[model samples]
Target: MAEMKSGYIDYKGFKTYYEIYGERKDNGKKPLLILHGGPGDTHLYLLNYRDMADLYDRQIIFYDQIGCGKSNIPHQEDDFYDYDLWINEFFTVRDALGLDDFHLFGNSWGGMLATMCMLRDDTGVASMVVNGSPYNCQTWLSEANRLILYLPEEMQKAIAEAEAAGGDYSTPEREAAYMEYYRRHVVGCDPWPDFVQEAFKPENVGECFNVMQGASEFVMTGKMKDFNVLDQVKNLKVPTMLLSGTNDEATPFLIKEAYDAMPAGTEWVLVQGAAHIGNATHAKEYFEAVENFIERHE
Candidate 1:
């Protein structure tokens, strides 16, 4: 394993922590800039993706978005956590690192952010890979409701009762029901991995998740409830690929909808038996698909 280089960059009066794995050699292929999910998820779970640096000789960069992970948290004002702030933060990090060419990879909410970045400007982005991203909130919620029906009857009842009571699904029973749904649709791994566990820690559960994503996956009581970029994706001219798991909350059906809205020639891949975080649960397959797409465009 290559030595990891970690540091922080000042972006608009906030500090953003980032780590770099593998050196950027004159390998022709550009470095990969990875955007993690959650408006609040740390780059910890995405550490698995650093394998791309080792296997494919690509420099892989992972960063904690402002107000999450090791980065400095700003005041949670009404105007603080919007799409433009994150998009600017991304370009700030890119410019600070002096990356002239790079491939963008974003998971879940991060995927939406990456798409917005491309839609804003593709001047430096060489290609993109969006994993389990939701382009339309209504489609996402509708699919989630469909999947919820497959849960055990008792679990379904518990979830319904909890959501009906103003999203207070924090009881032990409710937690158990949520986990049952998670094990099936969020992560297919039997025993959840440590990195995944770390993201959900009390201190690690940054305000962004609650403020941007709400209490649970199925519930949407946050500012991001109306976030939909389907109309803008058609203008994205960069070479892009979409990925989703067969059992993902961002189902293949939803991913296909986003793919259909993208400019023609965008690629799509669906991993079997994997859930939301396929890059973690199905690293080999995920990396192969990602590497192939990047190489084709390179």
Candidate 2:
């Protein structure tokens, strides 16, 4: 196994931590940056990418965003956490690591951020893979609510009632109700992974998510309330690919809408028998699809 090294980039005075796995090779493979989901998720969930060094002979960078994981936790909503803040942080980390041009992979929220970076036109992002992510938060939220209704009537009612009353999202009852739906639509047909469980910091997560995203998957009550990248999707100037699972909260309809809106030189694929966390649920198949996407662009 190759050694993994850690470092931090000072992005506009905020320190952002990142890790580099394996040695750089002249295999002509563009370095790959893996972005984890969540306005609060750490890069720990993406540790699996460390092994890809052997398969692809490219640098894989993993980092925890501010207020999440092994990174700096800034409680100030005013300065630290925002869409543009994160986008700039990505470029800061990439430039510090000397990644001139690279392939990008992001899951869920991370996928959305990756797309935002690609749209900047300043960053020389070579290609991208957005797995199980939607282009517009509003459209995706509607799909999530519809999927939640498919559960047992009792479970559906429990969720609706709690949200109506503004129940605490950190409570055991709410967690149980949400987890039931999350299992089927978020991760799909399996028990929650250990890392996924570890990543659930209810207190901090609730504040961060609610402030930036919303109250529920269906609720759009945050700074990103009107976040619609639909108009800009067609302006994507890089080789891009989209991935979604059949049971993904990022429904096929939403994915197709984004795909259809993209400029030419893009592709979309559905990972069979997987859901939102397709990369984890079906590692080999997911990685193979990603590998093909990167190779095709390279």
Q: Note the clash tally of each candidate.
A: 0, 0
Report the poorest 10 consecutive residues by lDDT, candidate 1. Answer: 71-80
lDDT of each model, Cα atoms only?
0.87, 0.78
In model 1, state the lDDT of residue 55.
90
What TM-score would each prediction reach against the true structure?
0.97, 0.92
> Per-residue lDDT tens digits of candidate 2, residues 23-109?
777777888899988777777655676677767777788988766666656567544468987888888788788888788999888
The pairs that clash in candidate 2 are none
Q: Total backbone clashes of model 2?
A: 0
lDDT against true structure, model 1: 0.87
lDDT of 1 by residue, 122-163 (tens): 878899999999999888888998998998898889899888
